[model samples]
Target: METSAYLNAVVEQTNTLAGWVHGRDATAPVPTCPKWTLADLVDHVGATQRMVAMLVGERMTEPDSAYARYVPAPGDPAQWRDWLTGTAAEAEQAFASVTDDTPVWDPSGAAAGVPFWSRRLFGEACVHRADAAAALGLPYELAPELAVAAIEDWLDTLTSRGYWENRPDFADAMRGSGQTLHFHATDASGEWLARREPDRVVLERTHTKADITVRGPAADLLLVLSRRRPLSATPTLELHGDRTLIDRWIEHMDWVTGD
Candidate 1:
C-alpha cells in the first residue's frame, strides 16, 4: 500500500471509531480486549497515534527515549472522540511529511522507515476499530485493499526472525515437521501459505494445498488472524483439512502481542 492509502485508512478507521462510540457508554466492555472499556480502547488508539506521530514526525532514532517522551490524554471520557480525531490527523500529517524511505524507530526491530510506521498505525487503527465494533454490537467492514495489506503486514511480523528472537517460547511452539497453514481470500486475489519449519516460520504468497486452509473474504480473514474473532465461529470463513493444525497455529499466534 502507498503511504497515502495507509494514512487514509487510519483516518477512516479512527473516524469510524469516534462515530461508533459517540454518546455510547464509556464503560462498556470490549469483549475482544477483556481488560479495556470503550474509553480505554479509544485512549489506546489516540496514544498510539501520538506516539507514531512523534516517532515519524521527529524522526526519533531510539525506541526507549521516544516512548519515554510519549504522553497520554486526560482522563475525560466526554472529550475522547475529539482527542481521537485530532491524533489521527496528527499521525496523517506526520507520515505525509516524510518520504517512505526515511529512517525511524521501530520497537520490533523490523524494517524501520516512514512506510513501516504508517502501515503499523493503519493496522492498529483497523484492528481496534474491530474491538469497538465487538463492544458495541455493530458490524465491521474493511476495504479489500486495506484488509489484504493488514493481513500481509501482520503475517510478516508474526514470521519475522528478528521478532521471534525475543519470543523463544512462541518460536519453539510453532516449530514443526513442515506442517503448513494456508489462507485464501475467496472474495479477492489474496492467498498465502505459512509453513512451520524446525527452526523458523516460512511464509509465501501462493495457491497450494496445506494441512489446513482458511477461506474467506479478506476482511474476515484479517479479523480472524487478529484473533478478535474465532475461525470456527465465523460462518463466513470456510476451513478445510486438519482443524488441529490450524487451531495449534492460532493458539501460538495468540502469543504474538501488539496493538
Candidate 2:
C-alpha cells in the first residue's frame, strides 16, 4: 500500500503486540520463532522500532556500527506495554517525517530510501504480531491489502540476486530447473508464480499453475510465506500438487532475517 498505511500498521501492530505482553507469561515460547521467548520478542520488536526510527530520522546513508544510546529497559514485563507503545510512536513519527524517496541505509542492500524501511518494517511487525497472537492463544488477522503488499515486498527480497548473494546457502537452495511454486490469494487480487531457474528465482503475477499451488487468504499466505507459520501445519491452506517442492521451498528459500 502507501507509506501512511504502512506506518499505521506499525503503530497498530506494535500497540496490539504490547497489549498482549501485559499480564502474560514472559517466558512463553514463540512457536513461530523458536529462538525467542515472549520477552525476547518484545525487546526485539521495540528495540528494532527505535533503531529504525534513528535511521530514518537521521537519513542515514550507511549502517551504524553501534546503537549504544539505547539501553535495556529496567522494569519487569508489566512495564513493556508502555515502553513498546512509546517506541512505536517514536518510530511512527520518524517514518512519517520522511518521504518515500528520502535516501537511507538498508542492511539488506535493497533500496536506499525510507520506503524500504516502511515496507520491511511493516512486514516484520505483521509477522511478529502473528507470533504474539499464537503465543497468547488469540486469533490473528491482517488486512488483505497489507498481506498482499507484505508478500510482494518479501518476494522482492527473496528473488533479489543482490540480497541472496551474501547468503550462499540460501542462493544455492533456490536454484533449480523448471521447478515452480504458485501462491494464490483467494481473498484479494494477489497471485504470484515463482519459477526456479539454474541461476536465480523469478517472481511474476499470473495464474499459470506451477509444480505446487498454495491457495489461501492473503493473510494466511503471508504468514506461511514469511516462515512464521508452515504451510503443512494449517489445514486451512490449500496445498495442491507437489508437496515436496512446497516443503523444500519453505525449508530454505522462505526466511528473511531483518527488522
Candidate 3:
C-alpha cells in the first residue's frame, strides 16, 4: 500500500472507532482484547498514534508514551472525533514529511522512516477497528491492497515482539527445527511463507510449501493470524497441512494475550 493510503486508513479507521464508541457502551468488553474495555480499545487506537507521532513524528530519539496522552471528552462523540482528528493529523503530518529512505528508530530494527511506522500504525488501527466493530456488532472491512499490507505489517510486528519484546513465551513457541507456515489470501495478491526459527525467523513474501497453510480473505487472514478471530469459527478461512503446527503458532503467537 502507498504511504498516502496508510495515512488515509488512519483517518478513516479513527472515524469507525469513534462510531463504535458512540453507539455502544464504553464498558463493553472487547473479545479481541479480553482485558480491554471498548473505551480502552478506542483510547488505545488514538493514544498509540499520538505516541507514535511523538516518537516518529516529533523525531524524538527516545520513545515515551506520556508525550502522546489524550484525554477523551466525556459524553460527547464530537469530542471523541476531535481527539482522533487532532492525534491522527499529527501522525499524518509527521509521516508525510519524511521520505522512505529517511532513517528512523524502529523497535524491530527491520523497518525505517515514515514507511515503516505508517504501515505499522495502519495495521494496528485496522485490527483494532475490527475489534470495535466486533464489539458493537457492526460490520468491518478493509481495502484489498490495504488488507494485504496490514497482514504483512502484522507479521513483521509480531516477529519484533517475539524476539525483541523479551516475550520468552512467544519466543520459545516460535522456535522449531524447520517448520513453515503459509498465509494465502484469496481476495487479493497476498501470499507469505514464514520460516520459523529461534535465532533467525524469515518472512518470505511468496508462495511456498509449508507444514501448514491458512487461506482466507486478507481481512479474515489478518484477524486469524493475529488471533483476534478463531480459525474454527470462520468458515471462509481454510486450513491445510499440519494442524498441530498451526495450532502451536496460533496458541502462543499472540503477544497481546501474554501467552
Two-way lDDT contest, 1 vs 3, winner: 1
Q: Give the poorly placed runs of model 3, Cα more than 4 Å off.
A: 65-78, 161-165, 257-259
Give one digit per residue, the lDDT tens place, for model 3 in 1-259.
Answer: 7888888888777766765576457778888788887767767778778778767765655454435455543454446666766778878888887777666666776556567788888888888788877777778888777788888888877766435456666766777777899999999999988888766567888988789999988988888888878888889988889999888888875655312
Give the per-residue lDDT of model 1 (tens digit) for 143-252: 88778888888887778776678888889888898999999988777899999899888999999989999998999999888888887778999999999988887777
- Cα lDDT listed for each candidate: 0.84, 0.81, 0.76
Over 83-198, each residue of candidate 2 has an lDDT whose tens digit, in order, gives 98898898889987888889888756666478778877787788889888877788999888878988888887778766778778878888899799999999888999999888
Error of 2 at 26 (Å): 2.0
Q: Would you list the clashing residue pairs of candidate 1?
A: none
Off by over 4 Å in 2: 65-70, 73-75, 253-259
Using all chains and alpha carbons, the TM-scores for the candidates as numbered come to: 0.93, 0.90, 0.90
Q: Give RMSD to native, each candidate.
A: 1.9, 2.4, 2.4
* Top candidate when judged by TM-score against the true structure: 1
* Superposed Cα deviation of residue 77, candidate 2 (Å): 0.9
Candidate that beats the other on TM-score, 1 or 2, i.e. the better one? 1
